[model samples]
Target: MESIARQSVKMCPFMQRAGSVQGLQVLHNANLPAVARKCPVVGHAMSRAYATASGTGARRATAPEPKAGSANEMVANHATQESLFDYDGLFETEIEKKRLDKSYRFFNNINRLAKEFPKAHRDLEDDKVTVWCSNDYLALSKNQQVIDVMKKTLDKYGAGAGGTRNIAGHNRHALKLEAEVAALHKKEGALVFSSCYVANDAVLSLLGQKIKDLVIFSDELNHASMIVGIKHANTTKHIFRHNDYDQLEEMLQMYPRSTPKLIAFESVYSMSGSVADIDRICTLAEKYGALTFLDEVHAVGLYGPHGAGVAEHCDFEAHRLAGIKSLPDKSVMDRVDMITGTLGKSFGTVGGYVAASQRLIDWFRSYAPGFIFTTSLPPSVMAGAAEAIRYQRSHLELRQLQQLHTGYVKQGMKELGIPVIPNPSHIVPVLVGNPDLTKQASDLLMKNHKIYVQAINFPTVARGTERLRITPTPDHTDDLSDILLDAVDDVFNELQLPRVRDWESQGGILGVGESDFVEQSNLWTEEQLSLSNNQLNPNVSDPVLGNLEVSSGIKV
Candidate 1:
């Protein structure tokens, strides 16, 4: 009787769309196959690779179908007249005027690094630290070529756009950039947002609203903006554990396969510097009849073959910019969907973009509050980004040199007994173990040796996994490396901690425990504490006092 009732519930269209299982709604909407073979064309490469590595390729893959009810019909039946204005029954506490401890939050660690390494500054470190904390990978922020381009654009277009893209902001240069970006990704069309954050937020929210009964399956460790956008969608969402493909597959299998599904993720996670397996994800999405939205902010200038990102990068150079300098020559207008990126990090400017279809761009320009309500980026800024992008491609040697420096530092840290996470990426982090101790170590390095490293703590990282995020750029020379090593050695020794070498020799994982990593970095020692206490107490330490001569005529 109960089994029959469950089957009846599953047959209902509204129940399937709502993801109702066992009389309760679940997050995900689609069930995908265990193996990637369901999508033949895309998964062929993976299948072959897996087959060669393993003994057989006869593994069965299964995906559940939707019940009698359709997700589209369920969504259409539930549309509300005041849906846009409806704030009730939503997760109000998460969004509505929440308070946070702003005082202790790490808004910008780069600024802190500047204060610590004052002598390294080219200018006023108090005002501006000359240190290498900025991920301005292309040096576009200060590059003369970028400056020149900005000046030229400003001269031509004058300052601000004065209106949204739909208004007067949609200039020839903007269109050209969008086309160039779409070509870079080899997509049908691309849309540009003001910032990468804005792009993620707007894209997720807009897509969720546009698609009638959408279910989003997002990476657990996705950036905050993506999380915010997903929350705003107010529909069912599933969070798969960080990089756990099996777990993701399991979640997909349990979801009702009626509603449209979307997978949102990033290529390179900024904090951890972990790269995503995009091809696998895309394959899974396709198998489940889902679309993919990738944030290539970190990977845009560095990852792919032509820097298009993981998938395109693995394949081949999608688009090669010809000797043409200016936007377009009234030809080659149509392009693919948008790829979003920021000008700040790699491009060395301040703006963001989305490269998508003209229709999508037109729609976003009309609606998306972030794009519509906000002031557009200055023409000079866009010009600078354009120049930066071009400069990066032309000057491959310089970029290689920077990467080499990063490699040298990573190697140095490993040799010196620091437990750095293993990844080929440039950003290297030294596991410091605890939040308080990590902060103390950073302070000591700054005060004594003027070596600055930003201390990353929760909720940036999980609790008990705090670390010192050390970024080594090209400007950080070999001499600096020696100084840094020596300083770290001195500090570690002074703290009365066991040497990193001795621990490594014993095959012990350094910084894996509180005693190993946290307690070792504390600047204060038991002996030092005892001496301080003795001095503070007058009668307790008579020996040193008696040895000292009286200054006045009346001596004891």
Candidate 2:
């Protein structure tokens, strides 16, 4: 509570001997610095900084703090007190909003029976349903050999990987599995992670963080994992329209060629069955001096001569003709700097990987906390996944059959006046524009028809684009197709869902029932489909495919 006047009066030794007015006049007459005049101890030179009369740049030395628990301190403590925020209530309100909007998800207990292939039991062992929305595109999960390999390795290596790779988890199985993944994408090296979700998140994050001023150009409709990784990277980002290369090019042009950039996209967009032009995107990346990050999670075991993915499939004939050499010429897959894929989907195991140049792979292996801190996949899974990749690579028949099944479902849906958002890949997306109806339709399919097709709602796909994303494997045969088609027809009729005609009448959306919608030819051409496994090149080696004895003999 000491004033400047009182401080000066108290500070001056002369003021103690002389009267207050006479002592003040003596100090003023001495012409000391304002700070010195205020207190003899402070020797601040700038009068403006030490000025007692306040104006701009006028500052006062801080007063000493009161002792703890002093009566004067009570007021200061009261000023800092703040009420607690209702954090749990905030979560409750957000969840309630999702519930009210019908975007809330309710999971079904559908346990897929390995023996049954495509048909799964729900809750009870006997309570079965036809699975229409699983991502096991080639049905390799049902292969007895793959299962046997997993079982044998499981018996040998135990249930879990001991720890992360840097600890006890690094072993021959991990190396072999990584080799298979690298060979699948024809990359110099590959690094495995707990899941592809983690792989995308880690790789994209590392690129943006390590490379200074790295700008990421992501597809607007990219998977949530990529988007999350981009956000975590905390760098400049431009989201181009989904599959709109022109907008992407324009944005790329705005940046100098020397500027570090990355174009992150997916090979096959899971929601709409849409396929990206991998070659074209690669070309743009090359032109703009941008690194390409392709997520082939959905397309890996469903495309290319060796089931490498859409990038490899872009030059199918060249790869297929390469035979023993693997790479006769540079390919779109080769040009792509990084490719991420899952062992869980087509490979029928559970993990993810990034196949890239040796330096990049090594960099991630050393730096990515997502990979470093997490437990490694069990040996059985690694073995099984490697087997699946080798199995699919040798069997071109599986991809063909999957394409055939997808075609059948799409054809049936079109013929039945069902609103199918068309694309060239092996996905059958039956668009239901309303969230409530999408949920209702998904529930009804499982309840009445015993068909399980999970509803796609907002956040996964955009609003008003809710759909039932159907995935057809090689095992979904003509008989099963007939059943699925008939059940779907009945469900549509009962639900009174909009048909193709209805969508067209409403001016169409997402390529569904649009009057000017261009019909996309299937990714697999007629000639390609006609050629079978018997026509495959004889010189190709199958290093990763073997029984237990040959486990360590993998050459890939």
Candidate 3:
């Protein structure tokens, strides 16, 4: 009896839109037999009877189906409603905003070079354009050694790691690469992630969430990844002024010494090319019982004697030059509790890592979902990264040549009266100050001059700080440099942009002595001028000196 009733229920069909309306009316109107209306199953049959009588069958046969422009359009229209939420309207508004502001990003599809690197040209509308905004600083992405290792590993292991690290994905290549990175930074252990951004986010989030009464002191200019991690952790955080050690110290003093604190910052700021005072930051961290989390993503595989990072270089340089080890308890690299770096930028591969004590690494490995849940990096990537790191370790000449190129471009820009952000680091930013102008200069450089330098604008840097960030590598030749400068000069003239400081009257040299030059450099705001003046060492000839003199018409 139960089986027969269930079968009857299964045999009943659901009514269409019009049938549903008529079926509801039949329930209100006493038009059915008492037995048919009283029994719930029979009542349902009566409703169906009323639906059929209401011309539902005729409506189904006579009404034509709605025609759709496309399958995607049909689905989109059905899924979205303007009354609830207008995703298309929101997108259109954002597009219009970007268009009006002239800050829309253009993705130029570039073909990989077989031989030439940093010096290689990109394919854009049937023209070969030189790229000046590549993050592959050392041009190791196209290195034959790195490529050969990756190819061999790919052939041996096949593509894709079959599972997460805890499963079948655990491989010798990843283990070896982790070990190599650990040794590079002189750490007890290291864990690899999909990217440096992920490493930073995972490690920071875990640390902030786990630590008791945790307080994160972050630089105001710290990257988006670090900010996201700290924000998600829901911990107390203090944002210090960019590169301002005094402000950082002041903030640290407010926090109790017993509280677990983390000083999170980057070694090299990408946009401005400003180097952080890592030594001083470490000192303050020790004074206030704070662990230093340094992101050396921009500095690793570029700076330092062994291409470890800036912290390593600073320590090595200090010991070699002054024979004065300022910190008695910890070496420079040791001062940093967590060091996050990437294989993508200078190393010229993909992925990121965090190097620290074995216990810290183990904690991350056990607790971090980003690491535990995601598929392990393929054997080829690990092999390639390991090879790249190994090769970079001994290649000091690449570093030197890169510095030379940076110095050449900077000095040339200064002589040409172009407003270049003065920094000791290997980045050169030509200030445009306006978004429209920045985009215009970049477009002119690409279309007319065949040179590509991306315009860095709002959210990347402040809105008024829009500029073209040019990165010169070891492979960017003297001829190429000349062409780039000339093209930039032409654009500046055409756009009627502001020129650099009038230092020609002061013997055509930019130094601390020239107050007008210092004021006009536009490297720092009024608040930063005093700090810059104090740090400017006029006698120093080293290109990496925080405040070094720029001689007129200087060339490499």
Candidate 4:
């Protein structure tokens, strides 16, 4: 450890060397007992190194402590041993001089580029660029109704909510918004957080504390927020492969049936847009007496007959999805244990909410540090979100438009030889093998074609699975589709990337494209025969239910 420390110091720049020297002085004058109490080898070695470098007397190690805790523990001594000039050859990099003689070379270069190459990295806004970078699913954020609602709230409530939820910030609007969220998700109570990331991170940590011997069966591809929550909880967790329901069941069966377990996952996985097997997973949770936490951040406003989400509406209980009893307004009066959603993405605002039993809401209010430490969301923002949700729920046509746009884009990408993950929802991704190439493609799209799609890279995605994430929203007109697809073709052609086989080409070879592949909608979408409803979501309904033409037809 000492030698490794020495090597690390040697590699460090001059200021670090100076800090180390000062640190050694503090250690040297400290009583021997105190030095041994903290770190005998580490402290003593640092002291010796500093002294030797200064051409002082031969240094010796500190003595041992008799007891683990003593008055000497706090005392640290430093004798003036090394002068700065004597420490030659100790740092060969001239790191101190480099640190002292800092010029604005990096910033100057940026300034030079800003002037000499004004048009090189010019703003594309003036050029009328089409963007597919934001995760605005329903594209309702900028909708006239949504914008009007936000404006009304801003005009009425001013800007910030002013205080924490429990304090002066507990406005009528915030309460009404929580009630609205709970009603939307069909739950008993809902607690809002500053953001979905905070909701995930704080809730799981609190649950881990409340539950005994909590064994978390987390989905491997759960968002980073969920991962952080599980970690902060400091409980043993098993990560099942992404969307692997059977593997999850196997792990669940291994645990003692009575043990407290949590099967955590997201409904609409944002990156891949692959939903979980809701019914199967829910049934397993019931069988094993484990609780379920499903994140519907990507699904809240676009699924079900009224957008209640896949688990209650789509899953194996398809019949229940349409049943009057399972409806959002009705279900809240009946069942639904837990549900979480974000206000930022589809809601067109910022924050997150958890809907569960009243008891759970009360527990989170008292225990969640994320909530306790931070100020509550402003009333204006909450009011704006409430309006967005109401408008989104009422605008069925807008939802249809979003689904249609996604279908058109996904199909066009496929025909253009882009390898996209088969998904049943609006989020579309074009997988590019190399990260550098993926970023280059993003740049090329923005620079040459005035189209913007982000290059999704690790640790956001697995290695070799990096992609240009495209989110086709209701606002993204069908007219812009050709521009995106053509730009992708150009970028890929320039990069010498080979065209990979997609579902359509693969289906044609298997003699299934026109015949056996004619399947109807499953749990993800409400539309029956829309192009977006095709094989993207593999959970097809039984063919006997209705004669659905899969080739081309808009159900809505």
Best by TM-score: 2
- Put down candidate 3 lDDT per residue, 195-246, tens digits, no spaces: 9888888999998888978999999999999999898778999999998999
List TM-scores for all candidates, in order. 0.64, 0.84, 0.75, 0.72
* Model 4: residue 203 alpha-carbon error in angstroms: 0.7
Tens-digit lDDT track for model 4 on 456-544? 77677776667778887776676778778888899988987545553344443211132354322334354332423322223112111
Model 4 deviation from native, Cα RMSD in Å = 13.5
Candidate 1: where are CA atoms >4 Å away?
1-103, 106-130, 256-258, 316-338, 357-363, 491-556
lDDT score of residue 413 within candidate 1: 71
Model 3 residue runs over 4 Å out of place are 1-82, 119-126, 317-329, 502-556
Q: Kindly state the number of residue pairs that clash in model 3.
A: 0
Q: For model 4, what is the alpha-carbon lDDT of residue 128?
A: 46
Compose the digit string of candidate 1's lDDT tens values, residues 67-144: 435554222221222225546646554444222311134333444232233224423455433343456654556677
Runs with alpha carbons beyond 4 Å of true place in candidate 2:
1-83, 539-541, 544-556
State each model's CA lDDT, in order: 0.57, 0.84, 0.75, 0.66
Instruction: In angstroms, give how far residue 251 of model 3 lies from its true place.
Output: 1.4
RMSD of each: 26.2, 9.3, 12.8, 13.5
Q: What is the lDDT of residue 437 in candidate 3?
A: 91
